[model samples]
Target: MTRTTPARPVSVEAVFPELAAHRSRTTRLHPRPGRPGMRDSHVGGPMLWPADEPWPVCQEPHRPETEGYAPDEIRSARAAGTWPASRSWPGGGTPGEGGPVPFMGLAQFFRRDIPGLPAGPDRADLLQLFRCPLTHGSYLERRYILRWRRAAETEDADDFLATPPQLPLLRWEDELPEPCVLHPEQVVTYPWAEDDTLPAALIARIDAWEDAQASRHGREAPSYQSDLSIPPGWRVGGFPSWASTGPLTVDCVSCATPLRLLLTAGSEEMDADSHSWVPLEDRDPSPHANPTRLRFGRDRDLHVFTCPADPGHPPRWLLA
Candidate 1:
């Protein structure tokens, strides 16, 4: 006699109890579009991760060894005719002695969140349930974060205007935020609400974009992964004058340690190139007199300076 196996349950409730729980949680919270969630702020602010939650398992970390080229080696090789001189470095430079070199790789490798997903499951779920304030679409979007120097605050300015007007704000779509091209080690998410004053319509759009990403993810088959690289035509910009004329100081975003500035564009090869961030030997308070000054505003932002103390190492994402 043959033995028979018991039949498994086929009901919707049986196959995915967790999905049901997710739905219930989202329904209970009923977050309005643009409202602050537990993981991220409705207004711009730092990202918060819950201590008790399990981190998502599907994240891909950045692999620098696999994707990056050594600056010194690349430069030497180029000088020897091994690599093309026109090749651009990510974050855009060779590491100098005094100042920290700007990171020159992909941005995705530095962040850990899933592209297009909120920082945590709670925010992701909340965003999924949110309806577009304007179109009522269920899609979500992603945005990018940009950094810039801060200017002094003024009493007359609005509370939101405390930072410099030229400071680059990190912005992204709620649906599919771009991954750091180099670091793939981390994912960039909404660190804060935009201006601490997001409109409901905008929030809805974010939610819709996120939903769209999820749908696309589900429908697509997994594909082979490749190393990230800078787009051919793109180049990193924005260096400060202090970087070229040394004794420069820069603080790390992660550790707050001070870095020293060393070397600006040195040598004839660096000087001849219009788009290179060559290291300098020392501060030249009179950098304005240098011919490179003409390149500023005309070709790119002034080169900023930094040092390589602990925690002051440039982020890898900036390289690409």
Candidate 2:
């Protein structure tokens, strides 16, 4: 089904004309629970992986005693309405031991389906996302794996793995994402209210405007942050909301080039406070607000930023 965002109650540009300069477009990937295929743009679905190419895996060390289960097994357990106490741990060994731990297929996006989706190296048309079930590094971050492939090349491969080995031992059950189909919709968005790029005087004016609005309309009064600035959901290529942690400067470590937001996996399609962002078709109050059912750290949104100068550079992620 096609999802459409309702028109903004108030014209932000009309109220703050100078803020028009920061306006940009973002593609909302309205993910709904469904059966997604290998060739389709989807979340937690089969990917168009080359048959001969070896599947990617996580080599980082994980506690050998932790309970583990593969993605497919997890789905099966969910269907059966019973999560297993323990599952076969792949590449099992003692603590600090490392081996081939299969990575879960998180998401896949085709340039043809999503507008403003950043191009991969060599102008590739498909972007595949993967994540290790285990947390790694000092921050206990879930490692994200990216692959840029040509859809045409995988079409006539000698053979493909209809069912790839689900070997990764997921540490957290919440990390597993249920399969979801995408309904891509492009919409206008502006930077966060606390974005450092905006001039201080304009911010002061906006603060004054917000205060006056509160006085007039009380809690329901439209504010720049929640109602006008950013839409909350899984989206591609737009400004990131720093509501949780103020503004942050994200730059490429390989080079000094400023990075751009590539994708965001938010917990909610629209929160209670940001009802304006709810799609017209889904305006009716319902429990389907979180179809994907995936939650990030502390229920925060995961924002991935990529280097514009070189797509091959490692992308950075921020949980905010």
Tell me the whole-model lDDT of each prediction, alpha carbons only.
0.22, 0.81
Q: How many Å off is the CA of 121 in candidate 1? A: 20
- TM-scores, each model vs. reference: 0.16, 0.90
Per-residue error for 13 in candidate 1, Å, reads 5.0
RMSD (CA, angstroms), candidate 1: 25.6
Candidate 1: where is the Cα deviation over 4 Å? 1-14, 22-85, 88-93, 102-320
**Residue 265 lDDT, candidate 1, scale 0-100:** 21
lDDT by residue for model 2 (138-214), tens: 67667777888877776678787787665455665666788899999999998887646588878888889999999
Per-candidate RMSD vs. true structure? 25.6, 2.6
Worst 10 residues of 2 by lDDT: 88-97
